[model samples]
Target: MNTLYPVMLEPQEPSGYCVQFVDIPGAITEGETLEECLFNAAEALTGVIESYIELGQEIPRPSENIKEAYYIAPDARVQSALLIRWARGDRSLADIARALETSWPSAQRLENPHHSPTLKQLERAASVLGKKLVLSLE
Candidate 1:
């Protein structure tokens, strides 16, 4: 599934725009222009997700009903980390480690947003999780 979150871009006083994420509470940001606002929104979204991971909280899934709403995606590393964690579901990291024939720490690193896992590592993890790793540009 494409991991694009919907955001509401509201015009602010005097000129700029304020962006609020539809699914994530408190994940809000503002910019002096539409371009800058959307850019800031991406950073805000990534930060929120990173915070969630650090707190061991479940990351909110992107809403699909995006009619008339602007959408944004977090950076690739955050996206990859979230995707792996979400796909792992109830399975243990140790299970994935065993299937990948790697140590637990290595498999665990796949879910660390700060650690950039190689494409091969991500693909193998997805395969073991019975999911496919899909990448996109935009």
Candidate 2:
């Protein structure tokens, strides 16, 4: 199934930006500029989807009842990544919320894959997760 989720971009100091999957926790991409960040985001999303499919897990479907939401064409590659993450037993929603200094509900929304999270929130989440946020020129 194809799912559309909002990506939130935030500007950083020195000249760079970051991207995050609004609905998926710990899914983030960064770039030196807005355009680059978006490009990278698309790639990351693809990878996540692919990973999920490979694991033979049920990929989450976006709510059909909602309108005005953009769906990222469902890609097996991106789904696979998400599946793997789910299997690995990574940070929980409450854990992430406390780490990011946000509330449980807000963090839950970030995991919805339908909500958009701000860039600043992404950066902070990355830090908490011990993931490196990178911005490339290419």
Candidate 3:
């Protein structure tokens, strides 16, 4: 389940770009430069995901409306989380739960895209998968 959402970048006034995710309405931001806009978009997307998870709301499934829209990759948090789950592969969820010192259902919840995972949890999962979760800003 790729969470890369389609983003519509609308130029505003003389020199700024306003970006909005098609599937997750209200997740939008503007920046004076393309680089800044992407950085802010990543922040906005992560906030939206965290809010939905906190409120116990389901994060809407991404639409196929990317026809003419540019895609924004999921934020670092999401990327790391998904990576941990994907790396789990043939490994059992129960095994993951045992590794995380949690229950099976809780482990499954970690794999849920709508649920935002804590950095510590992600690192633990990555460690269990024999992978290292690294983050760098550029």
Candidate 4:
């Protein structure tokens, strides 16, 4: 799934730009320049995603058909966590653990935003989840 969230940028009074994710309410930020605004938007998006994970809430998928919207992605760690959770779908953590031949905690850590799972570990998890781990430079 594409992880880039579409955001609307509104010019603030006298200076800067305010950014809000189209599909994620409460994830907003502003900065003094377009570059800074984009940077802060990424941070804001990551924070909101982490909060969603902590609250056991489903993270909203990125909208594909938004017009005149700029796209931004969360930090790599958050993106990895979200991808793992989305790939797991209705499958239990135990199910993933069994497929990976690992303990439940280890498999659970793969989806932890705070815990950095190795690339090999992520690749293995993706394989088990019927996904291919593909990385690209933006």
**Whole-model lDDT values for every prediction:** 0.91, 0.56, 0.75, 0.93
Query: Cα deviation in Å at residue 113, candidate 2?
Result: 19
Candidate 3's C-alpha runs over 4 A off are: 79-138
lDDT of 2 by residue, 94-137 (tens): 88778778898876654444345565665565567676444322
lDDT for each residue of candidate 1 in 1-138, tens digit (9 for 90 to 100): 667999999888998988999999869999998899889999999999989987899788899877878899988988999999999999999999999999999998999989999999989998999988777777
Clash pairs for candidate 4? none
Flag regions of model 2 displaced more than 4 Å: 63-138
Query: Clashes in each model (backbone N, CA, C under 3 Å)?
Result: 0, 25, 0, 0
Colliding pairs, model 1: none
Of the candidates numbered 3 and 4, which has the greater lDDT value? 4
Ranking by lDDT: 4, 1, 3, 2
TM-score of each: 0.96, 0.43, 0.60, 0.97
User: To one decimal, what is the Cα RMSD in angstroms of model 4 from the true structure?
Assistant: 0.8
> Which is the leading candidate under TM-score?
4
Q: Tens-digit lDDT track for model 4 on 39-82? A: 99999999999999989998889998789888999999899999
lDDT of 4 at 21: 93
lDDT string for model 3 (26-136, tens) is 799999987888878878887787666556565666676667786676666565545655678789999999988989987876766666788788778878888887765
Model 2: residue 132 alpha-carbon error in angstroms: 42
